[model samples]
Target: MKTEYDVIVVGAGSAGCAVAYRVARESNLEVLLLEAGSADKNMMMHVPMGFAFLLKPHKNNWSYQTELEPYLNNRVIDLPRGKVLGGCSSINGMVYIRGQKEDFDRWAAEGNKGWAYADVLPYFMRSQHNEAGADAYQGTGGPLWVSEIVDEFPIHQAFIDAAVQAGHSFNAQVNGATQAGVSWFPRTIKKGKRYSSAQAFLGAGRALSNLTVLTHAQVTQVQIEQGVAVAVQAEVKGQSILFSARQEIVLSGGAINTPQLLELSGVGQQARLRALGIQVHKDLPGVGENLQDHWNSYIKQKTQGVKTYYSEGRGLALLRNIARYLLGKKGFLGDSAATIGVFYKALPQASSPDAQIHFAPAASEYDAQGNLRPIDAITISACQLRPSSRGSVHINSVAADAKPSIRLNYLATELDQQVAVAAFKKARKILLQPALQGMLQAELAPGADVQTGEQILEYIKSTGEPVHHLAGTCKMGSDAMAVVDECLRVRGIQRLRIADASIMPSLVSGNTHAACVMIAEKCADFILRSSLIELVSPTRPFGR
Candidate 1:
């Protein structure tokens, strides 16, 4: 059976929620949002410290893995994306950050018109209702709630001070005029609770009559007819169904699924689709080519006397913390896991923002699941800002339920390696600072004897893995290789648009949630204006 709506938003992620919420609240458009996972009913999803718990297979996430990176000895790295109603933001570290200004300015210079920092600032302001109150760049009363550090710890403060002593600036806000500094990170938490996209957008619109949210509804393909998106084919409870988009279709399925869905619906390379036994609809060659993300080489340190979260003796404390969290939203469950974030240029001649540092207070035992294991661990992760390397994602076969092939051509550039090396040395400096020296017992990951640049380069090559900030599969630009235009409309297609991280021409500096929602806010305006123009002229296809 088929159901129709003015707009069908796929993925219900940070961007998808923003798109549906804005369309429902601002415009008279009826919207339908479909999520691949179940409703945000998991208790762990609401507790900030519960991010690690939700990373289990067949839980609140689609636990995907990359096809082995040769540099890391062909180890398949895990990639956990949110499958719940709010998407990854629901399971993210919850740190609120907007990247450096140059990141956006570069997008405008790269044929993406009006996407620079200045042009998009208003939308960013429009979506935030800062708990720290309004600032020059922040909003006073927007849907997405952002607040300064509501809960602070001693270790977190020392990390911030150590960064300052190591020549980094101490700015209260990272989302300000300058981004190259260490600061107490602002988060999407309101009243000491996790404020996910589900809370900000979906929660606000749940009572609205014009909006319908379906969880466990995985969209397998976009039903395109004569080069236009008409409906979406979804699977719910092992049953297949169709939902039509009356006005337009917005693909917010994120970096991986967005491109895969487009490719499955025959909207990518004709040669590739033909090989997969699928008929071609449009030949948009840039479907899933510009994959980008942050990668970090962890530096582990052993600590003494002062009990750390990752120490062997702290297991019971952690259990007590978990119990405290379940009983009342308190303890480690309130932590974002990431206590500190820093953005900086690796070298003076660096063309744009080059590196970012993530400070995890826990030890090497703190795995990708964001859970703490026994050991005193503090991670100093550095990622390349604008790595020259590029990758692609495509369907493994014609079957709609099959997972896509993700090839991340990591370390394909010498510059990417150089920045990573530089960022590591800098990270070492911060850890070795006198303020932190008392706590650290030894450097375990990369020892003090590893001095040469070549040695550090090898260490990075051998140890680095992605920070999981994937983007740019359906990049927005006007070039031949560009998949979507500046306004986010697909090339050679009508009434279809991509409103997610996939449309990012270059990955933003920090975590992508804030920027993704900002993109949706701007796109909502574009879509609304296009609809208004159509009503007046009753002609024109809403494009360049």
Candidate 2:
């Protein structure tokens, strides 16, 4: 293993993969990208329908769960984060969505310059090789491949048609000019296979020769020497090893792990670290604060007329699918879990679409121990897009591998509860549409008994699970609680930066992977700039 690199990117996740890719393509800097899990060579990971493969209690997943949410009648839910090369991108449903323009405009409005939708669109376009062809909104010869659904099932188109009937517009693309409509969700898949960020960046970046990727290497702490990140102590195959970075150590360990790493490295709240008997390097109280996630609940319906994923094609369906995948890469397995979507104002008084909706043709639910159980039905899950609730991630111990306390605190705010309740009402309306009514047999989940608003809220409290988009833990801003600056530099610490969903100042309007890719691409630009920021802190009086 190399002892030193020009840039050390800890966490070969959605952002870290992009960082290494951009850096290697732009500069000759020796970059080291590390991942805690093994390689992304698993065939199950490439199949779009195999999204739940790594999400299970597997080696490729972190398998973390949130504590009992006191506000939600005390329910602990599974939080599966990717540990492989592509990180969550590999395990996720492969939904390729850039949040609404207002999400970025809001960030720029909050003093994060160069983060407006207009400013960041080019980076998104630069990273995308959309199958829809190059246009003002998309690019052609980019790394990440974004395409429409491979096998567009009748249920998908039926759902979209049903949404249009329910007083919504039929949008060809949700990632286009507007985000408030029913549309066919774009996916990070190409040729019927899942194309994660690692496939787009690291897979292509290996040819650059300067970029090095190390799998199964878990970083424990960033060695802060005199308030400057000099190296990192990591565990590799039961051996603790230190790797030095000459320029910076970029933490892309997502929302939960990034903050945990910072605190483990003695760079969080002094009070917490002191109690854990660890020396404090920086007293950044917001290291794990401001945690947020989208609260989504499944509303399923038993359908009779529709042919769902559960139906087998007479005999040898599994064998035929495997053969088809190996030969032409076209089959049911190529289908994304969520091929249809809707964005609308759930609450009567809400402006724009405050809720995001997903339509799954196949009915599936997490069984005990968190395994996906397929059912012969259809499901429409809803999540309030911009929830006002906030939660936290913190550590009370120093063990690097020990799971930290994560509290999503779902529906902690009145607005969130109100919007969520309204969202379910809208979901019921769409399910009763004439198109879906033909296929629908009965309400399977939170069934006909759940009608009243109070009963719906109770049902939500009983069945709501996260869409698994956790973000904003180590927020970026100029506030006292800001863990990172506008440039993503860690507050009061030099030669360190965070480039992941964790650094988002606020939750984006939709799925976070696309936003995360854009963030990492921007981080590469900041690092490559000839003139860096010059900040003077207590320990670094000389310069930044």
| Model number with the top TM-score | 2
After superposition, the stretches of candidate 2 with alpha carbons farther than 4 Å from their true spots are 312-319, 367-369, 530-544
Candidate 1: stretches off by over 4 Å: 311-328, 366-374, 532-544
Question: What digit string (tens of lDDT, one per residue) describes model 1 on residues 1-544?
Answer: 3388888989899999988887776666778989888888887777776676765565777787778776556767778899888899888889888888988998999877899899888888888898777777888678899876644346677788888898888877788888878877788877657899989998888777778888888888888889888999998889988999887889999999999999888899989999988879899899989998788787888766554556422657767876776677666557675767877778768865578777766664556656545466667777777777788888879887788888777877877777878888887888878778777788888888887888988887776767778899999998878999988999998889999999998888888999999999887777777774223222211220
| Residue pairs of candidate 2 with colliding backbone atoms | none
Look at candidate 1 and give me any clashing residue pairs. Answer: 49-333, 310-375, 362-377, 363-377
lDDT of 2: 0.86
**Overall local distance difference test of candidate 1:** 0.80
